[model samples]
Target: MAREVLAGRMGLREAVRVGAYADALADRVGAARHEYERQSPESRAGEEAEARRYLAGLRSEIDAERAPSRR
Candidate 1:
């Protein structure tokens, strides 16, 4: 469970900062997994391909969300 003692005391900006840290941790974990797969010769090519596709999809989704609507 998350320790919410400090969370109650934090302001909105601080809470967003905490969330940003959590997002960063997720990115780091993904990078670590990619690296581990990269080090294995047999699975390396397939893993790298998967990682590229995953990242491309994520980027495209983020871009779409950021884009302004035509209406």
Candidate 2:
């Protein structure tokens, strides 16, 4: 599909540079994955909090795309 090809190209570039806000959003999600994989918190509460934070970020990005931009 078109998405797969586009994603593949972005991955190849290492950092896709989706402007300022989107770049920060992508970094946050990547950091969350790293935290979970490395078990950085070592507690159920911390892990759950990280998960919630990441989900909230995803929701934010979705909302941003769906709404009109001021810029």
Task: Note the clash tally of each candidate.
Answer: 0, 0
Off by over 4 Å in 1: 1-40
lDDT of 2 by residue, 6-51 (tens): 7775552344444654577688899988866776445757768889
Specify the poorest-scoring 10-residue window by lDDT in model 1.
1-10
lDDT of 1 by residue, 47-66 (tens): 77899999999999999999
Candidate 1: lDDT of 6?
Answer: 56
TM-score of each: 0.45, 0.39
List per-candidate RMSD values in Å.
7.8, 11.1
How well does candidate 2 match the true structure in TM-score terms?
A: 0.39
| CA deviation > 4 Å runs, candidate 2 | 1-42
Q: Give residue 33's error in model 2 in angstroms.
A: 18
